[model samples]
Target: MPLPGTKSRDAALIAEFRMISGASEKIASSFIKKYKSTEAALDAWYNDPASANGGTSTPNKGQEKKLGEIWEKYKDSSDPKLVKIDGTLAICEELGVDPGSDSVLFCLAADLDSKVTGEWEKEPFVKGLASYPGNIDSLTSLKNYLPALRKKLNTDPTYFKKVYMHTFTLAKGQDFGARTLQLDTALDLWTLFIPPALTSSPSALQRTSDQTPPQFAEEEFDLWIEFMRKKGKAVSKDTWSLLIDFIRSIDKDFKEYDDEGSWPSTIDDFVDFVRTRRSSK
Candidate 1:
């Protein structure tokens, strides 16, 4: 307490910790002292179930009010209660994310329960922020929450699948009645959603002993794209949704692929296409 400059330094650290973890000053100070840094304190706070129950589980009334304020700050100029593309870009900037980043945008959309790509209504926007693990009232808290969200996309297949499927809905833009995704748009999305590897096989793609099972072999993905381009047809909803099942069910060599199965016609045709190409090679 007697240290002159150390008081300000401690206060700054405590403030940063409070912002990130929504901890009170006393709690923040205790964590900071125990962990010796703001980052470490946050790590401890996130891992501690007792602390998390109080601060991180769900936003309290004050945090909900703060979320409303943040929403108003970024609301669309035209709509006042909506967040459009311009507002979304501004929010992305505040969160330290590139507005052009597809993966981050996908994660954000899933987290915020965004119904479409360029627009967010007030109900879902504030509600989703409130549902987030920790209090995210300010840019600092939002920025701090993003890494964990992105990591969930990378590490949890089930969570990634949920987000990936929602991406199709988002990609439809404002068209609720749309049943097909355009060929170019579908291909671009496949490239973004399907994790890529440099090699053609799963074994070769493994960089570590504990790597998760490969989702799409690069060669197989290329063949699918080639077949789609050659067909020159819009991707039907069935085809798009069934592609995930197809990828998970088939062997890399297509030995397990069954044309007689209940797969969409496009998938059946793509299997034939793969076989024809393989025979020619």
Candidate 2:
């Protein structure tokens, strides 16, 4: 028989443990009672596998069911298998995220392993959620996890690069035949991806201070945007992807830039633009 009040207070504990560890009800109950918390129980299960008995660290039936329910709830009504922009917006609303904020939206997309900007397929949705650490069986849990996900994006450079590269594809939309991103769109995306401090908006600065250090100063990003407005027609895939590399490799004053290096002509032109502005000042 289940322990007293297990149906009330301890239910979430058992469910989370079972979801992460793939333990049976009896096993989950035993571990919870022994360890006293979901994190502790999971720690014991992973650090000392014998304590888990036969429970495997994999998604179990319960997780699948819960994920399925969430999918059905958020999936596009017309397509049933896709979470379209409307569905995506609903999710953003639930999570208290601004759909207009590409920085946070892109991070969320990375977490969901989204393949498109406005659409999410069932497979990636299920696999991403199933593989995500911590409990995300409900929207509430997923919302609670967003801070950690954002922190990872801010702190983990490699992971941030993955999301950054992925954003190029997402921003391009479903036009597979297109080879370049629109200049206006690229400018908007750069503002979001580069760092919130670039905008000099009070809210963005606050967010930037709370997160990672800025990769480039506000003046640098502003100059780049100004140069783009003057000379850029469209942003090729190479330019779009290499901009991050440029920011990381070059200093704010362009002291480290090598004209002989393999930077794209667009970046080369921007450097020239910067030099001309500096010499005239």
Candidate 3:
């Protein structure tokens, strides 16, 4: 009693659900039955208009006005010698926000956009607060606004890792190491991950609610195996065990590799040196 193309459409929908959810065929089939199509399912779950505060698209004008009022009070003074970054940081501090936080960075950037060039500057910064998405006009409203935005954005749990790496390139500080603690604190608020270790205090451990063991990407493990084989070492569980130890050690003393922003760091270089001096049996 099936329609001519019903089987194909159902098959395609099931496949799409599997790809999107990484769920098994049985689970994806259940989802497909309930939603009918991938697009509908995604939209219903992610962009639920009912949950989006009555589907208001633009920033709330009343909140924007409140933010604008605050901006006028804290807009940069006409002192040529005062660094703009310093002024921005001071204003964020007054608002009880971490100046280096991604939320602050995004909100401040939006708040400071210039009308002429759409660049973050003093005048437009005040004007931009009247907008939605990243409005930081008022700390009081932010308590409610941020949660709503987070739901809208569907922010991934691992988003902070990207933020963490991006900061190194974006930040314009010579001694960034000194402010590493601030970065850790700020990133911890936005993402859920137990850092392998904290360089600031080697003994300090950050455990997540799940308390599950750290998960390594398949490619990371592959690279470890490749590196060992290239050095003419026998690939074994012991070798992987050593590499895991190395990874933990690297995380514990990240400051040592903080100078280089590359993944796995100079840990390989150190490993290579040790390998060279080893006596071949």
TM-score of each: 0.73, 0.72, 0.36
The lDDT leader among the candidates is 1
lDDT of 3 at 41: 52
Compared with the true structure, what per-residue lDDT tens digits does model 3 show for residues 1-281?
98899989999988875554343476556556778887555344333422223235455677567766655555446754222555556555655566433343543342343222112343354444444333335665443344433222222223323332333323323443342323333234323222322211111121233322323333333444445445553222233223334443343223333334433433455444434444342
Candidate 2: where are CA atoms >4 Å away?
Answer: 1-57, 197-215
Point out the worst 10-residue segment of candidate 1 by lDDT: 198-207
RMSD (CA, Å), candidate 1 to true, equals 8.2
Segments of candidate 1 deviating more than 4 angstroms: 1-57, 196-212
Error of 1 at 277 (Å): 1.8
Better of 1 and 2 by TM-score: 1
| Order of the predicted models by TM-score, top scorer first | 1, 2, 3
Supply the global lDDT for candidate 2.
0.71
Cα-based lDDT at residue 69, candidate 2? 81
What is residue 204's positional error in candidate 1, in angstroms? 18
Pairs that collide in candidate 2 are none
Determine which window of 10 residues in candidate 2 has minimal summed lDDT.
Answer: 200-209
Tens-place lDDT digits, model 1, residues 1-281: 46778878888999987765555577788888778787567656644535644445555788778888888888888889688889888888777787655476787788678887867887777777666555567778767766655544554445566777788888887788998888998998888667532232332233232443654477888889889999999988899888877776676678877767899999999888888888998
Q: lDDT of all predictions, in order shown?
A: 0.72, 0.71, 0.41
